[model samples]
Target: MQKLSNLIGLPVLETVTGTQIGMVEEVLLDIDQAVICGVLIDSENWFFKAYGIGFEDLFSIGRDAIMVRGSEVIKDLADLSALSSIYRLQDLTSKQIFTETGFLLGILMDVVFDVITGEIRAYQVSDSIITDLLYGRQTMPLPQAQVIGPDKVIVPDTMAKLLHAEQIL
Candidate 1:
């Protein structure tokens, strides 16, 4: 699978028409499944203002080409809310994770997907020290954590306190 970091900042070009679509800004993952469902495109105008464009107006016409429906190209527009939700991220290996205290926990190992709901259930952490200490000779699933932002996943202080108190096992 392609890594998210590799795709980020990469220029999205149109193969058929040779028109440049835009660079990927952020990737939207299914909260329940942790799988990437769409990508957010950078649609700031030449003056660096966000132009709001709806997803319906942006269609993928070719492998690399994304065509806007109207006469105005994205670069000329100033509103950007609609363009923000149009692109979807296809990969998910480079998402970062951290502890509530701002400690580096680990990178995302994989996303658990729920078949019935078709969403991300939990995130898998790949830290060897934490995994070995917590599981201890048995395999256990990664702890279910909350995503606080696009770049931050936080285990609540209450949950962290519980885990520290040995109440969660």
Candidate 2:
């Protein structure tokens, strides 16, 4: 498991030529399916106008870098923003989260996801002042989280009762 935010900025190295291509700029997530499609690398070769590798093509992901088989497989689908569910963790960072009933929860701090399966496991949320003074930070179960839009996320109000401040620290 790894935090989605951490994947950004990791170097992408081509295995065949050993060329350091670029750093991961964003995470392409199929949010409706809750799976990671791939990563968007802002490549050094602007002329090529294309550089993205699917998760299946990734040789390995480590603390240092991500290894891909070769450059041949990297596609040039430049405008992935058109894809409705193309969720970039960086785009959602610090966004406000609330309950379906319009109760503000807090800001979205982080996401814990499976590196192997690309499934999001939990959301580490910073609580709003009223709740923060009571529970501090809370890790909401994935089932409770509902992304209402780009600006806010909603979790059921009852979701807060499932855990106390002691569990999160």
Candidate 3:
């Protein structure tokens, strides 16, 4: 698994032409599915609209760059219906996390995802920015989000032990 945040800023390369087209600006995440649907590419020109590549259209994600079969894989953001109106990684990061039973876990930090499938496997959380800087964050297996609202996310109550145990460890 790879951290989704790591993909940001990676160049998007067209394999057939051996040309660099754009860089990853952000990721479109389907929160309900716990998977990344596509990526938003940074437009090289200020006046040009940014584009996106659906997960299925990507050729591969490498250590240094993201590869696409060709430039045809890129499309206007509006053309990517599956990704056009979904939650983004930025939308969820820093959102508060709570248990179904109303216990506060921490703040959402980053997610570990399957590089090939885009499936979210785990979450990194921090009690606070201060604590995070001092002691580091905790990584917990995601049991699926029970609730995702504008400002907060709720996870299964069972995750409480998982998170707390990791803290003790």
Q: Quote each prediction's TM-score.
A: 0.37, 0.80, 0.84
Q: In candidate 2, where is summed lDDT lowest over 10 consecutive residues?
A: 160-169
Top candidate when judged by TM-score against the true structure? 3
| Predictions in order: lDDT | 0.43, 0.73, 0.80
Worst ten in a row by lDDT for model 3? 160-169
- What is the C-alpha lDDT profile of model 3 across 11-82, one tens digit per residue? 999989999888998888776677788899987553456478989898998878999989888877654434
Q: For every candidate structure, what is the RMSD over all alpha carbons to the true structure, in angstroms?
A: 9.7, 3.5, 3.4
Which one wins on lDDT? 3
lDDT of 2 by residue, 1-169 (tens): 6777788899999888998888898877666777777888887577645357777778888878989888776776567645877777776678787777888766878777787777777677776667767756677666434665767877787765553342431
Error of 1 at 66 (Å): 9.4
Q: What ranking emerges by TM-score with the best candidate at the front?
A: 3, 2, 1
